[model samples]
Target: MTPPPGWYRDPHAPHLERWWDGTAWTGHRRAPGTPDVPPVPPAGGTGRAKAVALTTAGAVLVAAVVTGAVFLGGDDDEAETKTGPTATTSSSATGLPAPSPSTSEPATGVPDVVEDELNGVTFPLLDGWVRPEHVAQDDVVMTTDGTYDCPGEGSVCRHGLVVSRTVTATDQTSPEALAEEDIPEAAEDAFGEDALGQQPYGGLESHRVVKSGPVAVAGRAGYFVRWRVTTAEGPGGYVQSLVFPSSVGTESPVLVRYVFDAGEDGPPLADMDRITKGIRPVTDADSGGGVGSSIGPAH
Candidate 1:
């Protein structure tokens, strides 16, 4: 008999239950009693899907056109990012021609996909995401759809992505250390020190590491961190980073990351993963160069 729709133990992911979509296994699975974990997307599925996250309140940090410099940090004194939700709206994005092998046939939600030629990375961009006015340095890029006042207690934040083309090193710190400890501390030390440590600017809350564990990015072992941020009263975000495997380079990981801002119109973590998976290294940072190779004085 065809059983009614219900949760059943997943044969693939033994730890979770899989969904039987009447006709076949939908690939939507979860733990037996676990709550809040998002539905597992089916492999080779077709249809336009809005990415969702495990947490109820979460968004991502993105969209841009200008091909600019690549570096992390800025010279300007850190601005005190006000705590709570912002009233910014999604900014219009000037789309770029898809990068090499881009225009991911599978990615649909992002109409204006952006390509970073310098760093050899490309990803989908939300319709109204725009570039941030100022950042710590060129290597770090922050883009977002404006923030807004939410209907409920929290504010809808500017959802976007922050890409750090200049990550210091992968081996200097463990993957867990980089995601859980270093990333937040580094961000705070650079931006949060000013004021409103409780508040967040550019959709970033004084990020708090909520959960972390191992995950794969671009087929590489990595770390993922779910953060409980205070950008809005009830808003939050997540940061997922993967180091280039030792086969690539121990010194640096072509830092692959996703900054999700839990805004009213925020993109879900699952959607973010779809784009991150498309990232393909243009040049092998794994060959010859180890960590911190661009150190010598300019010729």
Candidate 2:
């Protein structure tokens, strides 16, 4: 029997024939009873032509597979490059540009304002008083009115001056308002009853109610008041407290209180007299020539 038009006898098996349609072979089988015939050459030349056609078709299939693989690999590489580690998301969840190069440098310039050596304590030898030794250390400057066998002792020792400036507030109320308001309980714990009173000195015109007294060293004026009470140190201590406001409207004032150790009679009335006299108001165009002077000492 003749085989189908597109069928060929298997070269290796006599009983089986395979189908070779235009393209690849079909692995389908014929019935066992089907007769097998040797393939005949075409009019043009059969074996070589058929072999060449089959070879060319196989080459095309290989090329297609290879091309598809290459295309898939290239796509994977492109995807990896786009999502690689160097790329990052911003806090806003959007991709951001890279940071710029830095050119930072350390700062250098003038120093901070500080007190000079003589800035703290000094006595310029006022008339009718002698500067004493015990309170005349570089840290403390004390001046006295009367004579005493031992310095810083005795009621006849009269007045004593002790000056200290710190960035602390001894009173909860302002120095201008201290005498008028009840003393804060905390102040009594540290400074005692003598720490009361508001004495007027001089102040800038803007501080209509606050007073300022003589700060002979810096030409600053502050308020002065006497606290006739005992201290953490001793009994019968006299404190001629001076308050220098930090600025026209600031709350905290720099206090320079002079503690004198002059018994129950307190420092000679002369000592208080000297302090009141020495306390001068700062004279400035804005001062209004003492319009807001404190009526008596600040409470």
Candidate 3:
């Protein structure tokens, strides 16, 4: 239930408090222990909650996204019919696409499926993929089997990686809009440069859209934009951004990104289609046994 109007920890700025005026977030903000000021919603009032947050929340989320960026490379796990569950929270906010509140850890024992309760979805682990052992945010990053030294020293990289999270920075719900807006950022995060400023693929140089269109995911109409990116150092890669609405909560927008190294060692691009088809609802995963059902919306 929505809490009564009051100052609460700002999801965008955890160090400060932003007013939650009953039904929506307000522009009024103050530090803890400070005297209260009458709530002053954004100039346009409560209706602008989303617009205000979209404009103001990015400063906080950029750090999270950058920090969570990792150099990609991985091994092989045969596809399995077995299924399991894993939970993760969402990040706070950043530029246009921000993060959300943290959620529970992934349920143990189910390796073939990763459940994101916060976003109300599940991602099937395709052949040669494994769930992440550790991650920086609520991201569910499924990667290929092994790791190799980076083109730059001091780190390892994976050949393929897929990450999913809730887009909490804006009230914008159009999957096509979110997908188009997110592709560049996703490409940069996965290929341009890593958290440490290391360019595992020699830093992204340029990119061209290979595919862009509407697609169904988890039975929800969504959109996807895929690009073939070129880098300065090693073999570049392909990245795609997929945005859809969560099944739970207010049906918030959810973002899923895919990164595949452009080499034979990387996963076959077809796996992208297979895994996308494998996505399902967390409840369905719990009751349906495994990922045999094709529940995602068709492209």
TM-score for all models, in order of appearance: 0.42, 0.31, 0.62
Candidate 1's TM-score: 0.42
lDDT of 1 by residue, 1-299 (tens): 12333454432233455444332334354556655333555466522121211110111111111111111223223211100111111111112122122111222343354444333444445445454443212222345555544322222334555553324312343555555544553333222322222223333346665555665443445555554455433355555544333223333444444556555556665654455444443343222222322211111
Can you rank all candidates by lDDT, best first?
3, 1, 2
Best candidate (score: TM-score): 3
Q: After superposition, how far is residue 52 of candidate 3 from its true place, in Å?
A: 16
Query: Weakest 10 consecutive residues, lDDT, candidate 3?
Result: 78-87
Cα-based lDDT at residue 64, candidate 1: 19
In angstroms, give how far residue 142 of model 3 lies from its true place.
1.4
For candidate 2, lDDT tens digit of each residue in 99-211? 11100101112111111111221222344444333221111233445533222112223334433222221334345443222112112311332111211111001101222
Error of 3 at 27 (Å): 25
Residue-level lDDT for 285 in candidate 1:
21
Model 3: per-residue Cα lDDT over 1-299, one tens digit each: 12344555553344566555444444566666566555544454353212111111111122222212442211122110100112111122111222222222234465567666556677777779876543332243577777766554335667887766656545568988888877777777667655455566666789888877776777777788888988776677788888777777678777788888787788898788787777777657643223323333434
